[model samples]
Target: MEGQATLNRRNFIRLSALTGGGLVLGFNYFLSSCTTEQGSGQAFDLNAFVRIDTNGKVTIMSPNPEIGQGVKTSLPMLVAEELDVDWKNVQVEQAGLDTEKYSRQVAGGSGSVRESWESFRQVGATARQMLINAAAAAWAVSPGECTTENGMVVHKTNGKKMSYGKLVESASTLEVPKDVKVKSEGSFRLIGQRIPNIDNHAIVTGQYKYGIDTKREGMLYATIIRPPAFGMTLESFDDSEAKKSAGVSQVLRIENKIAVLGRSTWEVMQAAKKIKAQWKDDGTLESSADMTQKLHELLAKAPKDKPRRKDGNIAQAFASAAKVVELDFDAPFLAHNTMEPMNFFAHVKADGAELHGPIQLPERARKRIAELLKLPEEKISVMMTRMGGGFGRRLMTDFVEEAALVSREAGNIPVNVIWSREDDMTGGFYRPMYSYKYKAAIDKDNKLIAWHHHSAGVGGSASPDSFPAGAVAHYQVDTHSYETPVSTAPWRGPTHNYIAFSEQSFMDEIAHQTGKDPVALRLELLEQAKNNPAGKVNYEPDRFAAVIRKAAEISGWGKPKAANIFQGFAAHFSFASYVAQVAEVEKQADGKVKLKKMYCVVDCGTVVNPSGAETQVEGSIIDGIGHAMYAELTLTKGKPDQTNFHAYRMIRMSEAPEVEIHFIDSKAAPTGLGEPALPPAGAALANAVFAASGVRLKNQPFIKSGLFA
Candidate 1:
């Protein structure tokens, strides 16, 4: 099987005239040359990203999947902003997986906007310039004399005007320009504005096509009965009863799981429950308790450590300190718990394979499916559906691969494999449980002198460049990890999710022990990092301090607010963005923490869409706070104890607090918004809980530690 084809500017873009008197701009990033040959006869390329009909209707292909981060709307805004087109006249179409045409279609790391900002603008500007040049040639005037506005090319001196559709034929004949200017940020009409999601109407009117809503001719529904625990394999199964159930068509064993296929999803789900399966444990499995104990043991042994960063002499500084504060923090494994469970549709045949699903990485999935089916990469096609939620879980292609395997086993029939909530919740690839041991020293002058951090987990080391690293004179970071059979993958902010909680909470403790304000302490350290830095700092200290000050000012930090309300603040930088959050909490008579409000300040460079950026920050804060307050996945003999919402507690609407978000105003290139806001939220909420209850909750999932009780 051939690997993914390389993409370059020569083959990445093409322009051609449409048969119906319009223009088609083909942009190739993922598809191979063979795939392009399929549409050779047509005037327009088969994978044309932009199509303008004779009637002046414009269609723009959105390359990335819409995973609820509003890429479908935000990305197109970039194109339309540069294309000089009205949003109402433009329609967005979701593009299929094509690595050669769309180089970075995968939607994770909050990079959709950050990565697409320049390329998408170029795509739009290139198209617009073609139209303007075509209009200039027809008018026998210089292209400089023509200006475009709202899909119309106009002559400034005269009243001559031409619709983009009318100039398409001429534009198609002109050579593709080597250089085209994009609009200045100050002149952007759509990029910085608050644009409603293009699919809002379809979503509200129940016309959106999510993966679960996918259907095809002769498609069979399937549900697999997987192992109840990790390190366990299928030993035997009796599917006779399932085969006899109503609507049951076939019961097949694929790999280590049994698949029950039927004519309907409900029937297949019902029949799947009746199939009795037995599994044998590998005997190497351990419970979450054992894993936690193992981490503690590793910390105690002071195993051979990999030093991530070292500065000055930590031992000497600690010995000379007037006061030393040390603390240990632990966070348990967590499940993604996406609103929509894992699902995919696949049809495998002798000639080729087709897959449609909500996935984060389609190009990677296409390659994996090709390898699994023993077919060439070009022989497979992958389509993306609007995802309900990903949160990094969809980055894994296991579910999509399963659908393909099941379809092949079902004699090349189209199969849709839908995972129950239990299947998704109990599935592996969870956020690894992590433990952090932090020690800080202060001089007799009440100045922070030394900082040391040791982290151990199943996956790998936590981020070592966490804040205060470059603020202290003697700072050292060490990591120790142990391998486990259990799988782990990125969850939102990944390492920052847990590290922020531990590090920021420890900072709060330091502030209390030194009789200093928590927010002020962080600001002072940031100032130190800016002026007299200890070691190399990856983040911009100025921007870091800006967000901290902004958050404090906006949240009324150190000011008297409503009675009984306490505020806590925390900040962190990740993914090239700086985020700071202030959480407001109130303690009730029942000893439970009631989150009242949250204030967030973000410095993600340029803001593409103000409303969308605000929404993302707000959503991230809620997600982070909810997980910190009451979400954890513990393993019992390597089997997830939390299977459903009943066991895995989620923050309800009534418990959700009012979130106020503000973004730093700047013209710098935009960074990502999805993951950066999350890291600080957990720390801010944890700090707030401490302020309100006068009890420091060292462990995560505050509910698990009886912090509320």
Candidate 2:
């Protein structure tokens, strides 16, 4: 464990050389998800990491992180469909880090679905073509007439067919298809249908290895003690008492830090607590309270860091408006709180290093490790384990880098670094807190005349401002960012989730003021986008209205359903898909909002798996609801305030609402399903609560702001 030794590194998963490394390449895909395989002979390219073995099992080296968006199943579904393989017979393997194959494994900004779907399809189509070519040669027929159906190459006219497994050996010898025609929507047998998750068996049985479960022979378990505050380096450490403890191997200072290595993780954790690690609290000039105060002030004068969208003259219209209303809303920082804490296993070598862990950004982490370890790109091997829950938390490589650093410190010996519950919580990185200010005017005709919106926040520095102030007549959307030591990445719907709560709530207010129904008001604006127009809204007005109408029909809108249960609605277009949500809420005497039910309608063009899409949409609604009501990651004096499940909360089974999701029938090519439904659900819930209580909740974690009261 103390020397550079790896017994079965090659036996585990061998890497292949790359075909493309750095060329400005627009991603090309077929019927699946994203294109990742170009193929080469060397034993380590990222593309080669994705392979169809002679057994006909497709090992999709998932480039995207899988905290729990189900990319592990959905992404491969894209490939399996295009490959014309039986979804039941397919197997997906996590990929090692290889950017030559994966360009954007950084999973955030709701780009996972729209970006990777077609590309993965290309990989399948290419493989399918090769298989068909093999079958054609074997049957001595033209390749044109041979089509694929459910993992078999069928002589379409003759009805003779061969399974993918039967043709694997022959297919491997055929020239890979360079420009093969992908199957049309009408010809698909799998792309738009409901299918079970491929990895569901592994997950249900706990056989799914996460980053925490990664182990190696002669690998030492270790724990790290980082500085309490950002920008603070280790001043000194005393591990004499820890080193003498049972099961402890050696407590050595590596890279100006103290690392406790032991035989077991429990032992290392015990030894880690005894080590008196101290450092100067070199943090920002402001505390959490200080930051809060500054954020409120900044919300008013949200500096013009960037203008995301602007059209018409709000100032000119506001100067001559009848009535104007202004409001400010705030949201605190949030922690990912993945069921599994951050962990990684690495074996650093002089020539290269092999790393495996629970990480979202696999390709990026590999490159970061390759550079941080000071080895050639070819020497680094990064592998992914199924993530317990990603939620945009696993997209960073900080923990992976630390593991590699410690492995090199241990003389390039194989080591698995484990982060305790505390380490995982306070380790570093968070969703940035935010504040928003809004001002809108009502004309004499009771119509919206002017709109001005400014949003300032942290954690969103890496996110693109996605709201266009909704489908408004005269609108302006302004955005700005604040710098903090807290590292932040994408979280589900990112900015749209928060903005939806704010913007959609404001839309409801305007609708009430204008004597128009909430749904009617949205329909009017959507009508504008449909008739004359605005710029990009991935959502077509008719399509968006279709979901709203469909959800309204299912929700019994405008009908005498119940006196206590109130309904509210919101719709949004994101990640190249449109989703509309109608929420039913009932107030409780305990001052908590009980979600009675939620109806969601989605139109994402072609559904590869209708059942999968429905499940994802339901999960998204619950995910957004739980985070909106109870999830908040605050800090005190540069340290995390919540460390474990007891303090942090997630939507539990009994608390989750009955989510009914319906899909629209469409012939459009296909769109994404991962995150499109998340944003509007939170907003719709808030609106429903407002209708019930006549209260407009502005801040996140509605319970904190007395939404029920």
Model 2 residue 147 lDDT?
86
Top candidate by lDDT: 1
Give the count of colliding residue pairs in each prediction: 11, 30
Residues 433-529 of candidate 1: C-alpha lDDT, one tens digit per residue: 8888999989999999999898889875778788988999999888888777788889999898889889999999999999999988998998899
**Residue-by-residue lDDT tens digits, candidate 2, 1-709:** 1111121212112323223421111122322233333345533333434454445455555566665666667777777778777776666666555554455665565556566655666656766777788889999999999988877789978999887656765655554455555667788777766677767887799787777887788889888877665556677888888988898987767665677898899999898889998776665634566667776777666455656666677888898899887878887777777778888898988888888877777777877887787788777777777777777777777778878888887787888888887877776567678888888988888777667877777757312224334455677777767777776767777777677777778888888777788888778777876775544544567887888788888888878966677888888777777788899998777655667889998888877677777777888888888888888877676666787779987677887888888889888756767777888887899889888888888888887766653
Question: What's the CA error at residue 604 for candidate 1, in Å?
Answer: 1.0
Which candidate gets the maximum TM-score versus the true structure?
Answer: 1
**Candidates' TM-scores?**
0.95, 0.87
lDDT (CA) per prediction: 0.85, 0.72
